[model samples]
Target chain A: MSESLQVNTMADLMAQGKKPEVLFWVGCAGSFDDRAKKITRAFVKILNNVGVNFAILGTEESCTGDPAKRAGNEFLFQMQAMSNIQVLNGYEVKKIVTTCPHCFNTLKNEYPGLGGNYEVMHHSQFLQKLMEEGKLKIEGGEFKGKKISFHDPCYLGRANGEYEAPRNLLQELDAELVELKRCKTQGLCCGAGGAQMFKEAEPGKKEINIERMEDVEEAKPDIVAVGCPFCMTMMTDGVKTKEKEDSIKVYDLAELIAESNKL
Target chain B: MGISNIFFIIALAAAGFWFAKNLNKIIRNINLGKDIDRGDSKAERWKKMFMVAIGQSKMVKKPISGALHIAVYVGFVIINIEMLEIVIDGIFGTHRVLAEPLGSFYNILIGSFEILAFLVLISCLIFLIRRNVLKVKRFGFREMLGWPKTDANIILIVEIMLMSAFLKMNAADYVLQQRGVEHYIQAGAFPISGSLIVPLYESFSTGFLIFVERVSWWFHIIGVLLFLNYLPYSKHFHIILAFPNVFFSKLDPKGKFTNMEAVTKEVKLMFDPEADPYAAPAEPEGPVERFGAKDVQDLTWKQLMDAYSCTECGRCTEQCPAAQTGKLLSPRKIMMDTRDRLEEVGKNIAKHGADHSDGKSLLGDYILEEELWACTTCNACTEACPVMIDPLSIIMDMRRSLIMEDSKAPAEITNMLNNIENNGAPWQFSQTDRANWVNEG
Candidate 1:
């Protein structure tokens, strides 16, 4: 997992007197969680491969305060959000692409009201745009005809009403896209929304992730695809819980694209 | 005017007084919430009201229930025109006063009303069957177990009765008109009811026909008045509140959330490097209260209005991923609990003064933290609501209160917050290692 790449930070870019086309918001999970870090690397590799000029905030990048906001700590959330906003404003950043739906949702929806307005895109949307521009070429490779089920992250699907970009990008892999019983607007949460990823499951008859995984299992795909880091964690955990980790695999959409393109 | 007319006037006054008093109490209770300015884009607001409430646009998303609801809605509105004539006749003791003035137009109006009344009756009966007989899944949730189910049934039955009484009165009036009674003039059309119901009374005498007509008229008018007063107590209040709720709905993109202005201001002050040491600070908004809502009073007036306007149709709960996946959170229950808490607070204020606390709040006393934490903040509830009642906003506020005021978040979340605070992210990993995953080839 340890690989060296020329990732420029905002501070580095500012010092060099250069501006990237887009700011890559590597969210907390994508920054640290072992599995999510892979998504970050894959997304970054794709950006690097496509010759897209993108810079990370590096040590300056902080949590978007999405979990704090959703968990009811407005003070903490604002503290985090404003700190990041000041940094972005200092850099005069205009566009941001992130691999985490939580960050994507907060930066896109919750930030404008706080005077931090920018064009925020989820990595799936960004990847789709790259493909449309013919910058990111794909040859399907090993993913051709593979049975894959795409899980819609709650923030990406219902919150933002974006059910197409991720799916459209997945279709570019030339794989058999099997849909879960509950997909799109009716997509089930992987039980990590509303800061639930950071909290212990409340008393319930069954964990929400397990229930969501039931929908995934019903689709019976070789690969469970996710566009959000939180969904990746939950789905992977669900696969582990079901003891089907050896048979069923979970991959972020960026990971699949990067793997297929051998980028 | 005779003694009976005076009696009718007194009844009308009493009903009006009761309805107005209750409405005032509702307004006062809703005003208990903090003020928010929903005064922007008046034109857009009016358009939303027309499309969502008047046009029944959102309701039609689910075809069967939507169509039936539109029938009851259209019937209730159109029949009120005839109600105006009834009010005039009741006070002045004039029979069909609009009939003479409206002429053939009055006949067409009456015909439409009669048809609408029949439609209302049919729709209500179907709704009743759906609730009680067929037992629709959305309508039979645990939240709808007791009074809610009964309340829904009662409203349906009452509507059926009201429509029946209206048609019966019209039919009996037609029968008396046929008998050439002096007061029962041959005016207005009752195409369906008169043809169907008049024959049942034709064997009766003029005196009997007159008595039937008078009883049915009284029943219909009194029933309507009772229904008017009942609006505030029942879910059927949507009939009145849906318009305002839709009109005042958030006009921005559905995904956008309102940031706390106070927090934003504080953030700006913190970020500003050019601060003067001797400058007097701006006057704070009442000593900087708790960050998020803890009770009904902490919510915005629109949020409180949302509680009042919820029809409890369960479309929100039906679509909620958390609820569907057997989680504790039900968006419909959130709205209902807010309304219940608001009512409790209202009652406490009515009993004691406005500042009196009942030693309880919406948090522990009504809505539980478990339910609050169970929500995914997916906005499915907001999208599914026919009246644009945003249950997610209420849940988020309450969660805010819990975390900020009470510091009662789950242990795991507390750790995550600490991680975010210390590491600048929601993980224990150091920030320096964030970009270590990248490979140089």
Candidate 2:
């Protein structure tokens, strides 16, 4: 197998040479699920190829409490946030990064309020940086003829403004990057944030996720490129509902990068 | 007694005149803490006011308020001609050649407005109380109370007086006919003269019927004109401005402002990923302090005018989650402040020796910063303003100033922004696994 064919886990990542002073906080979205283990490992390896040598600061990781805050449970939100902040501050970590938009949103947008201010960057942004620096080498132009569409996570796009990095990386992969009108600033919420991710969505005329997923259908792509893990999960469910699960694929931006290696 | 009667008549007449005039002046004052930066021309103000105020356009949205307001507005306008007869009869005697058509039409309108104005007034009072009273009954009223309560209240009194005038005129006719002297003065210089003032008219006559009619006429006519002239100065001003505000409403989509004055980082980044994220954002920027309205004066003149224009309808407060759930938010207060400020400023400006030669004015202290920040930018208040005052815009600019420049906001929200700058998510997540959600979730 090619050296790049094999991926490394967070344990292996630290065992390898570390270049930067940072701790990667694995969010509940990743820590809680096993499939997330697969995509995250892929992202970790992609990060290595990209020159990020930070150790996983998983020990200090805690829920950002955005879900509680947005759920109108202010007290619970404060409790969760304060505890997370104490641990993060105790680890004395200065910078952070994450894949879950919820974690990203809370850490970057919600946590600093609780006194855990740290430099946060989405994994997509970090990877896009690697691609630009020629650290994450690409091999396959095979998907050149295939069509792809990018699903912008609501927090990272409309909320935080990290809309383009993932799509630019995709375009470099030589896939036809189709655009959706509701893609960026006007990006529709996946009905998963503001704690909607955990609780039953307050009933409305139509489900927000369903509304967003329908917007995705119009792009008519062979694959839907996504950045945040929640978006991948949500859009995957959307793809299943439309029963286009097989024909249409949801690839995390990192997964796309890994798949692009053409090994 | 007749001497005292004349004095009674003059005193009521003088007070009514003063009240109406002062109302015009007062409605033009009350600072709303917005920035109505004399940017638009008189023509623009007139254009907005004409289409919005004179047009009675906004009310059309609330099928009930709009339809009722339209009827009341039309009735009020037609009642304008009706007032001409009352004033002429009060100051002099007889309604002149104009009284012929007005007499019959006034009766016809009694039924329309007697029923309609009463409903609008009662409904509006329910709203007025809803905004301040803090109750549940306000729920059913669609929260209609507002500064226009001034208009509606006056309208109610006017309707009652106008209705009474119709009733009194007919009752006098009844008294005169019963006394057997319809031929003596039906169209004479004294429509309700000596013989017409029989025992029935006498008891009521001893009271200031003429004086009351005169006061009511002044209230009706003066209220209409001053309200008209002050149309751009108040919240019910929307009852006038709504048509225009709606017509010019940012038809693009909900949640987008009218103008996209500059490119965002996404565009800049697309063009040059090397660009700094802190670069200035586009839209109404050069002299403007923030993206959202920084203060009351920051509001468009139409919005400043919307305070006066607001009918005091509490729909905005009713639908507002923060307000509904007991947060210290009231859309009516914001709208009222605009008119209130203008009225106050108008008084100061019109004061005998005030100093505003440079016109470098602040909206003063009408809206509290706390009030400004309390807004959730939910747009419900704007949606319910009846006049289309878009209070959210005023608030957003203030937020922009506080957040972008002053770095001010609730410590919680600011902390979130700090979390954003520090952590990839609002949590203390591992940066390496930002993509972990893809694999795990």
Candidate 3:
């Protein structure tokens, strides 16, 4: 838990006559899912430690309507997208960073068409940029030789074609990076995309996450690194299905970085 | 004019009539979809057509198959030059009509046609081997088992036969010229086929050689006419529809989904505090329509065009994460089902009146809800399609119908939607507790 950190909101920052370099869109999963909240804290810790001024939409932030849109509720999606766009336009937000690929994808890709344009970057991309600028120093420590296999969230990998930033950030941890047979453009989904995270999977031979978990098992890594909160939930559930939760671990890229640096 | 000329003209008229009737039926079926404005960006649309459909730019993404496809495609177009001359000769009782005035240039054109026919034969052979012998995984998917597989093989065999007929005609004609036969003028050149088939024809009498040439010539022209009419019934319709499909493809940034204009209006009303309260309510556009597509008629005309244009190469399904991970969803199937349903609706309209309702639709009966839910909305299907057929658009439209029209989302999804409505997010937490993670250090 990040008890000592004083997180600023866009409203608070504006009231203080200050503006952040980027607005952190803490998605629903990041803000409320118990497991994903750890990822949120870890990402914030990195931002604070690196001295990058960022603020969240905080109480004003809502779902980007990704699930709603994917689930086919155009009315709900518009209602949600327009609300966020209004708040963003009110603050004149020019840049955004989020830990969840769903929010990152919707805000970066979907928002522009709805007149909510912003320079959106996933936290992994933002972290890589920080590392390139020599602003964030990473000590690999315990994770130096550990095997880590990254599970590319569909929105980040296939949808956006961003296969390198997260991997590049992981390389900073000095971990033994392993490639899953199906990776990058060929990566399997964690079965939580297209608003699947909010629904029980329909009848099928086997659950998709379980099928994806087989790829993780084949990689045989110590850590199953993920970028999206939805992926975090699905992969975590997958590991539980394999009964390997005790030996294998599911982590966000930021969490791994935070752990390595002993933050 | 000779009696042969009269028969040839009658045959040409019959083929033309058959082709026109089928073409009209296809147009009527595609027009059954709701109208959408794809007329914007004329310049950009032309560029897309030229680049994607004409240049086969997207096809070249996978080099081996791409190269073979281009060979067949280029051959199909280039060989049509000979068809034009045949058409002119068939009606006017003139043999090699362009050859006399054009002379050496006509020889050059025939030489190129011979070379292209050979290429077409070879390309079709290789495509057959890839589809049947090599058994490419994409081609052998579950949905491709019946007519799709048969359709692919049939088109390839027809191409091979057409190319063979062309070469055989050239061969016999070359022998006739060697014999200095009257009415068999040495006009057009057959560079490759002439040399290759000369030995086989040398043993035949002049009359027999003329008979072979005549039969092959008639078969070649009639085969082409048959192929044209068959286009409406086969996935090979891409030969005609791909150009227009590429031209009218969604040109926005690929990741952007279309926002509902009706929803956009409602959102604007909610956002504006100064909105007129006493103003006349917006006029209802006829009857209230469902948000997304449930039947073929609910889709946009371009989407219907996309269905017609699908090559069924299964590249989209091959790239689909859901299909790879053992889900029921196949993007290729989505396009196929849409085409099938559209055909059904078209047939129904043809049998009954235009206003007839069969009570069947694209959704549930053809495409299952389970399959629609499996898509990750990853756009992999759209990205992988060589001709820009967007299965995701159809999938999303169906999903919209399921959710907005029927309110029949999965229970968990309903719960999440409820959370979003009540908590402003997709979880049970209050908006005030959204930043609680900041205090957890």
Candidate 4:
């Protein structure tokens, strides 16, 4: 699988005088975090299977500075944003897709002010579009008739008003989709946003992620599907803490789709 | 004019003057914050104001509370039309002056007012039960325990009294009209008062009925005036400010964090080769601008107005992930603290001129660093605020001042910022290793 997976860089494609359809923005979590890497691989596999022309920025990419901005380091955020914008503009990138909502949000909403403008889509939206066009057919395989609950990522759902795309793809899996008691606009955060992922949570009666998992617990699903990497890490940690990792599993939307399609 | 008419004029004048004075003070306090341009997109702002503030679109999201609130709100606004007749009659020493002109429309107006007044009375009773008897958790949060709790109960009780007095006055007037008494003309319909309550007042003496009508009329008018003056001190100020506050709401997508143009310029300068590194920077013309809000004065006028517009409904806090998880952060407390501190700053300015130092700031004096840090920036608070009060923006701006100005942040956050500065990510992984996952299968 590794040998046959074709990955091209923007620099390589530029040297070859070719342009890809969309740039796959593997955000920091997708790039280096071991767990999130599998999500990136799953999304990439689906793109390849669907015959989508996409390229990666590879080493030329940098963080979109979402964490820095949310953590209130405006100076650092602007520096990183400007540098990323410079590289992105130099490559003449137009359309972007990412497995992380933070990257998608920052690139789509926050970057235009710093002069980085591109059509950015989360992997959920991209996959939903492919499914809409009839290019991607998910057979549901292992997830057929299984109860799957989606934890809405704050950035993706509340921040960006995107609640349907991921669920639309989930419906394609032929699964029993149960909604958490607090879902959509009232969706709870997984405790990893606002740069909380890099820092220990402030003293509280309970960790936020654990509290959020209580909603997942109540839903009692066989699988918890998520769209963001930060939510992936938090929800997975929550499953482990409840010792329900055996009974209930957490998978990104892309991984679920890729597995269903046997990508 | 009769003696009563002269007295009514004096009372109205005094209440109007007092309310105007307080309103002027609030405007000054809000203007103490830095100027911001929310004047763009007039059409969109009007649409939002109409939908959220007038139409009560966001209030109806919770169904039960939404329905009860709409009843009270619509009752309060629509019934005020009757106040116009009351005012005209009181000023000119006339009785039911609009009755002759409005004709059948006046009957319909009074009938609707009677119905709305009844609904308002019931809604107030339910709101009181929810607050005091049931003790809804949102109304019981720590920040809501003091004057906030009393203020909420006070408004509900006041509304109940005002509506009761209105119906009682109408009942006495109806009985007087049936008796064909002087100046008590058969003018308007009073369904609730005439049918249900007029029986209670039927047997009293003609003089006692007149006494009841006069006393009820005066009480209702004076109570409304007092409530008008009370708006400045109570969270009920949302009644007046919600319109403009929603009109000035941030129209951008919730994920779009505002960019710091000052930081952008400095970064652009760093990347420019022709720029002189040794040259002294140009001084700003006005007072040196702070990087982010350190106090209310550093915030924008719209943010300050948001504090004034907050109804203290605790919807934001109820939906807050941090507050739900028992973290120190409560979004309601942020808006309350901002308003409290702004009031304190306002008093200092009023007493000792604008240059006086209060030896206090909103950041450390009111809001703790832990509360700001506890925020997930998930925007549930902003989404839940019925009046569009954005508590998250204040939290973020204060965080900005803490980090950028004071360089004070959690050790982990400092490390994360350092990592992003050096390694192009929030962790220590080298940039070169970013794409290693591509071949790691």
Name the weakest run of 10 consecutive residues (lDDT summed) in model 4 chain B: B282-291
lDDT of 1: 0.87
Candidate 2 residue B180 C-alpha distance from true site, Å = 7.3
Q: Could you list the iRMS of every candidate?
A: 2.0, 11.5, 1.8, 0.9
Relative to the true structure, candidate 2 reaches a TM of 0.46
Clashing pairs in 3: A1-B440, A1-B441, A2-B440, A2-B441, A3-B440, A3-B441
Overall lDDT per candidate, in order of appearance: 0.87, 0.55, 0.88, 0.93
* Tens digits of per-residue lDDT for model 3, B19-48: 889889889989988888889999999999
What residue runs in model 1 are displaced by over 4 Å at the alpha carbon?
A: A1-6, A137-149, A171-181, A217-224, A240-249, A259-262, B265-288
Which candidate wins on lDDT? 4
For model 4, how does the per-residue alpha-carbon lDDT over A144-249 read when each residue is reduced to its tens digit? 7799999999999999999999999999899999999999999999999999999999988999989998999899999999999999999999989989988899
Largest TM-score belongs to which candidate? Answer: 4
Per-model TM-score of chain A alone?
A: 0.98, 0.86, 0.98, 0.98
lDDT of 1 by residue, B232-267 (tens): 999888888999999988886555666887777776
Error of 4 at B222 (Å): 0.8
**Ten contiguous residues minimizing lDDT sum, candidate 1 chain B:** B432-441
Across A1-263, the per-residue lDDT of candidate 3 in tens digits comes to 33466579999999999999899999988888889999999898888888888899999999999888988988888889988999999999999999998898889888887799999999989999998899988887678778999998888887787999999988888889999878887677788888887777776678888888999899899999999988888899999999998878999999999888887
Model 2: reference contacts kept, as a fraction: 0.01
Clash count per candidate: 5, 103, 6, 0
Model 4 alpha-carbon miss at residue A79, Å? 0.2
lDDT of 2 by residue, B1-441 (tens): 345345445744765675567555544443323333344455655575566556755457567557756766665555455455545554554433353565765445444434444444455455445434655443333224443445544544544444444434444444444445523133322233233333456565423454543454445544444445544443334444455544443322223322212223233243454776687854653554333444444555555545554566666776543454344446666665555555555665787444453343222255555555444333446545545566655554444445444555555555544443355344345545554443332
